[model samples]
Target: MWLLKKLSPDFKTIADFRKDNRGAIKRVCREFVLLCKKRDLFGGELVGIDGSKFKAVNSKKKNFNEAKLLCDIYSVLFLMI
Candidate 1:
């Protein structure tokens, strides 16, 4: 963290540093994706897709689709009215 702090002299906050380096972050992500593709890290099999259990710390619920999101928002708005 201190080494990263030394590297940036203009930014006062971590958020500021991240905002300034957004392009660099994007470039790094693109390069990482290319590298993964080149190395065939995806293990091309149907079995590979369902073998993970990574979820957010707060929610047992998986990601929401458009309908679920609309329903949730409508319910909240209905309650407020």
Candidate 2:
């Protein structure tokens, strides 16, 4: 804590450190995973990874309700017909 306070590096410095030591960091993470596996620390039953990304839309034009969804669906079906 004291060391961090003394040398409070900015975002660029931290980013540079990460870029330079990426390989070392990956090796360290791999070794940690291996150690955990040896100890049967991970449950292989279920793993959930959420990588879903959603766009930010706050405008009224982009907002919708159940009525709006049904109307849009009907419009699309009508267009097809």
Candidate 3:
């Protein structure tokens, strides 16, 4: 087929290209998602957040704070004596 003048790339070349531009690919994906959302493709509200490291729990209000950290440190020090 006479689609273009450039020759077809081999598997290794394709793989290396992907490995080198992974971040760019992810950003492009995010932009595509935003464009789709602007076009009202999500049907309802769409919240795109990268929360892989966060855990959803009932004790969210009791999460880490300076007072809690200091209390834990004091308790551990008292236990060691």
Candidate 4:
């Protein structure tokens, strides 16, 4: 527990930080990945980006694809609120 606590930050801190610098952080990450691609860092590689996150109440079989994912996650979060 001690090690985990030491290595990981609380969710509030992470959330606050992300909210403050979300756009800048995303721009920097995108630039970094573009640089890597230009430099052939992932030579002949097929990259797949899935930004979907499954909610707790949603079954695994139903949680495929971006459109369905957004609906499921938002529905659960809205219900919680």
Best by lDDT: 2
lDDT of 2 at 13: 92
**Model 1 agreement with the true structure over 1-81: per-residue lDDT tens digits:** 686876755546877878899999999999997899799997766653666787655453756879989999999999999
Error of 4 at 74 (Å): 45
Model 3 scores worst on lDDT over the 10 consecutive residues at 54-63
Where is model 3 more than 4 Å wrong at Cα?
1-3, 44-81
Which of the two candidates, 2 or 4, achieves a greater lDDT against the reference?
A: 2
Question: What TM-scores do the predictions have?
Answer: 0.39, 0.53, 0.46, 0.45
> What lDDT does each candidate get?
0.82, 0.93, 0.88, 0.87
Clashes of 2: 0
In model 1, which residue pairs have backbone atoms overlapping below 3 Å? none
Write candidate 4's Cα lDDT for 15-75 as tens digits: 9999999999999999998999899887776767899885666567855889878988999
After superposing all C-alphas onto the true structure, candidate 4 shows an RMSD in angstroms of 13.1
Give the local distance difference test score of model 4. 0.87
Residue ranges of candidate 4 with Cα displaced over 4 Å: 1-8, 49-81
Give the C-alpha lDDT of model 2. Answer: 0.93
lDDT of the structure predicted as candidate 1: 0.82
